[model samples]
Target: MLKRICIILICFIALLANPLQAKDIIFYGGDKNSYNHQILHHALSYQQHTNYLVKTYTGYAPKQRAYLNLSNQEEIDVVFGGATIEREQLNHAIRIPLLKGLNGWRIPLVNKKNGNIFKNLSSTEEFKQLLAGQFHLWSDVVVLQSNNIRVHKATNVKGMYQMLHKGRFDYFPRSILEVWSDMERHKQLDIMVEQHTLIHYPSAYYFYVNYQDVRLIKDITSGLESAIKDGSFDKLFNQHYGEQINKVKQTLRKTYQLTNPHLPPKTPLSRKELWLDLNMHPTT
Candidate 1:
């Protein structure tokens, strides 16, 4: 009995000393290879406690369905998206702009033939006259429309590229971080990243969890905050985007600033460290 009691005590002590078992978290939406996906992994690595094993769900879910899954905590443990009032109502947003507000800096993707159209722009009014192509469900659609810019909507990404190539829209404004990869994907379509125009607005992307998932909410928020403090967050961001930033700086582009009426009121826009500074650009 003494030997058995000693063995039991040893096992209990070992359990107490070991770190808590990492939670198996199923991330239901977002591409596993995308920048946002990489940032998610980086953030989770900084967890102070309650380690997480984030596995991407292979099956696809539309944005609305993903929102529903996260809200219900059914299968999906987390989802990332642009900060919108409606989405925040359904789930708890971590509120760190995953892209550091770079998503708002759009560079147009134009048919190679019409590339010259963007080479010269005199005024924001002329820029607004061009029809912009965007996914109908994207928050950018309303933002562009609210700013008096005409927009043509596509139902899907592939369709947006097709529409742009077919002249169904004047130009497709793609985020600076995304436009290069998107360019490679549709290389067969003869589209070119516009050389000299940058559209600016305020936008933020965030990871969201079920409102009831207070543990995950706390873990992600704290992890990201810690990463930011240790400078790891900026390091990771530069690793992924430094090349693109250099390219944007090689040539001066006409900066057309627009208003984002949809930007959440709670966005930490005042946090200088959390955003990329495009204010150095000379406005046309």
Candidate 2:
């Protein structure tokens, strides 16, 4: 009888310890190697502050069309992507810039033989003469086309790289954080980074929750804000991206600023503490 009582007591204690164990939050994104996976893991790790445990599932959806379809179909509870007005209309955004506007700073990926193609390029008009590659559904396509820059649209990212290699486009502009790793990963293509130019605009990457997931939205927003307030967010950012940020600072690249017409009105641009300024060295 005593053993039976002890078993019951132990089971009760276990239940008490994990009262919300059944509440699982699903974070879906591309494969483990993708930046989306890193952001999902970092963002979901903070869910200990709420009554949920996060389980990540990598989906087959490509970068261009992942967020809307995944969230709308209830296949994913959370996703990370570049924030735009249309995207916010489709889902709820956490509004904290994940990369702190660095997504807007683009460096070109060009064939090794033509590495100096942008060396003497001085104006946006001259830049416009070169055709660039962009994803068909990406906000960057709109931004580039609006600036009078000719863009060749591709549905898949890997295919875009292949097209650039085949000279279907003059250059492929990729984020500074992404360009180096892409070049290394696709080394067989013999692409090199263009050292002379930087394409600048205002862009933000944010965590988005499904439209009906109010509890999740609240938890994520609170957790992210807490992480920011305590400096853990900055610490994590530097831990992953310090090398790239430092590389950009050391390079004498000429920057050309462009207006991002797709920027949402509610972007937290005034939150100075939430962003990393490339001009001001960020502390790890």
Candidate 3:
């Protein structure tokens, strides 16, 4: 009886040390600065006493797609952010809106004939035939096809943009922030540029995990619960980023992020509106 008890005790201690059982896991993320890292850091900090560890796979969005697809194949334990009506069909992700923020990409380059995306914009229906798992650039046809709007598989965003500028495609999608950043490099190109709404995205973000790891998923949910109750989560969010919620109804006047390289005439964003609009951007 004593011998049997000794064996059971050893097994119990072993279980406690093993990360697979105690907690320590790798997560896949789109990028290091993304909101995924924020949520993961918050969860681990809250559960550090419990010995849980969370790691991330940081890379670009294109690479992230490939990594996520692989995880889904094995359905292993993984944590990430990003969601869409189409991706939901796979059903391996647990849908939880970690936070809400503004996220939209406009096509800056357009067909020479259309003049500019901001002007000749037609409709999203103009695209719907994507070439799965294949693409090289960001072009009008690439966006239409990749989003299943038209028909083709492009390799990456840079490639698509090249095609757009070459007039091979009508437009290429880019976030306001991204475009704001990119325009800095192509200042002279603005002469042939215009923003398009076909690439508009209202809301896009989520905290999710693999389907095969049910136990890990529960741990994540529980960790978040604990963080929320103690105000740890909000505290962390505000610490890294100032208070996001604000009361500004007078004017959308935003603070001049003079940082915007391609700013047409240097419009000033009200200081009050600066942080407020950023609340929508979320740094990530």
Candidate 4:
């Protein structure tokens, strides 16, 4: 009898030991606009792993929700695609950094003939001066305003491309992956563009868990760390983003007048600065 009781006790312990509770993680992020969202979708697609249910909001809601930790108050489990600093600051946010499984491709939309406007303005500051009182772009304008670079904000990529084609905005920024992902959407837009800064902004994405679901965060973090250890992170990143990386590098070589098309053997920029360069890929 005692032996049988012991067996039951062990079985019970085993069952309790497995803590993947019925708790579902509410993943909040942008409206599938980011590559991080796609990667999270693939990772959490399994039936057993289905507890990580996603809840998306348009625009900056995910960012807002994360900073606010809305899901935590409602007992939701996790939020995907927040920055490391964000995770660190949020009391409940765990730092399970994920590889965004993405590579950036910086493309410049410039006029067909006048490349001199871009000559002295390789960095953002110089470019801002040249663009003083010029065409507007929300993204570029935001960057400029932060650094005192004034410019106008265009409605959308298509509108901005039209501005560039008509010699309105001097040179605009875009992601090659974004353009390729929506090739059909942007196909007929006759914008002469060159993609540069190949292989910029390789980063580990993260699942920031609320403090309320500390145990759940631990589980997800473990899974992700395992993924990282065995190289699953890079595998996924390289698999999906690899082709785009290659394509961008090739295009940038022919398109933009970059000092170096490929990432150097040793980069001069610090980690933080390098990431900025990778993300911005300003023609230098």
Candidate 5:
């Protein structure tokens, strides 16, 4: 009996020291200060709602097509991108709008000398005459081209910026959440925000997980819903983008509404609280 008791004690100690490990949910993101990093951090916050740990693997792919395709292969556990019907067919989208549809609110970047050029333009037809820079694979490219807007496609971010600097495009539309920081980083390129106009479309940014990883999808969906109900999601969004919203409100820019043909039919537009109404002035 004494020998049996000794063996049990040793086994219990070993179990204590080697407890079960938490499952790792791989996150593929961009470098620091990029929108990808912001999405990765938001995904990491979901960890509080699940036993699985989120681990970021940066620089997995520099282009949207590459990373999104990686998710299809199960090489990447999660990827953040604009929601589209085609994208939904490829991966399991969490379906919660990460930015509350703010990704569709585009502000343009243009040469400082030409900034005043857009101030007087009031129609999409006039805007279409100007060349816009965008990624070749971005859904926005399709939207722009469908609307008869001229586009200059670049495979990478730096190349796009260089193209803009070289006068290849008249304006580069950037999300309200991304334009400011991006401007600061590329100040040497001599671009300025087109203060007189903004673009509006119906779009959402969503976290898409591998279709085979149903467990992770459920965990993230539950976490996001809980965060929304508890107001934590809005708090985090306001903390990061509230100032930008306020600044946009102060500018009396003429907004041109564009149709996002790629938006999925099942988008949660009924959840009013999950979106920002540009018509109503932001109080933040």
Candidate 6:
């Protein structure tokens, strides 16, 4: 009993020394290797004085479950994903485009045998005629539908890939940041990235917190703004996506620029520096 008391006392003293830091800032729906996961910690690092304890959920949390957890503040503190007007109204969003609008640059995943099907795509109308696959809950679905593109909804990434491989959908448009990794992960499914086409729209991925968590909201927003101002945000972004960006710029592709009707009004459209100008892509 005496030894037990002594150990308990020591543990108490250690806890006193650390004071349990801030309420853990939990990220959901992604592992540490994901770009959003890296950026979350990176932005939060700018606010060391807050002493936030950053953690990621141990397994893949479905996007719906993550949002539910975030809404209840039960299991998640933040979620990173494409933004829409409804989402901004429901949560305390950091407003910084975590992907610098690169999430909007989409490349299609085609079955290997049909890889060259998009090579000569000449118009947005022609592109729209090809059926696309998207997770039903994603903002991308709405964007595609609003643009008159036909989309078949899938419940998960694996199923979507399977559907694409089996010809249930003509193509699955994945973000430029995601397609390479996805292609690598699902290589066994006989899918390939469409080589000669790119589809883009205006979109932003943001860190969102429950509306009641004002302190976290302020800290995250300030931290991201500080990171942006200091160039660390771009540095980190380039470190992860520089190769893809460079390749997309150099590639010869027919580009389709779509309009996102549901984009939140507060999106920093005026912040020219925060967005990549795909217009700079070579026409060749």
Number of the top lDDT candidate: 1
Name the runs in model 5 displaced over 4 angstroms. Answer: 1-21, 30-50, 58-75, 135-137, 154-168, 188-190, 279-284
Task: For model 2, give the 10-residue run with minimal summed lDDT.
Answer: 275-284
200: Cα error in model 2, Å: 1.8
- Cα lDDT tens digits, model 5, 1-284, are 99999999999999788775567655665444555555445545666434565566654466466446655664567777778787788788778888788888989988876878787675667877888899997788988888788998889977887777777789999998889888999999868888777787888888877788776777677777877888877877787789999988888777777778898999998988888877532111
Q: Each candidate's TM vs. the true structure?
A: 0.84, 0.76, 0.49, 0.60, 0.74, 0.77
lDDT tens per residue, model 4, 1-284: 99999999999998788755453445565445454565555455433633655555433443655557554464334566524344445645434434342323345555556544454445544544644222352233443455454555665644665666677755655555564654445546545454332323333345665666655656665655565566665676667567766665553232222222222223322434122222333343
Clashing pairs in 5: none
Score each candidate by Cα lDDT. 0.84, 0.77, 0.45, 0.49, 0.76, 0.82
Worst 10 residues of 3 by lDDT: 254-263
How large an RMSD does model 4 have?
A: 7.4
At residue 147, give the lDDT of candidate 5.
79
Task: Output the lDDT of residue 253, model 5.
Answer: 74
lDDT of each residue in 1-284, candidate 3, tens digit only: 99999999999998777645355565665344655676766665555445655655444345356446545643224645445444444434443344422233233444445553333323333232212122544233333343445433456755554555555554444444454456556544422344223233333344556566566566677776677678676565555433222211121321111122221222222322211233222111
The best-first sequence of candidates by TM-score reads 1, 6, 2, 5, 4, 3
Candidate 6, residues 68-126, lDDT tens digits: the string is 67888887889887787777766777888888899888889999888888877666677
Off by over 4 Å in 6: 1-23, 29-33, 58-62, 111-114, 135-138, 152-169, 185-191, 280-284
Q: Among these predicted structures, which one has the highest TM-score?
A: 1
Residue 54 lDDT in model 4? 57
**All predictions: root-mean-square deviation over Cα?**
4.3, 5.9, 12.2, 7.4, 6.1, 7.6
* Steric clashes per prediction: 0, 0, 33, 10, 0, 0
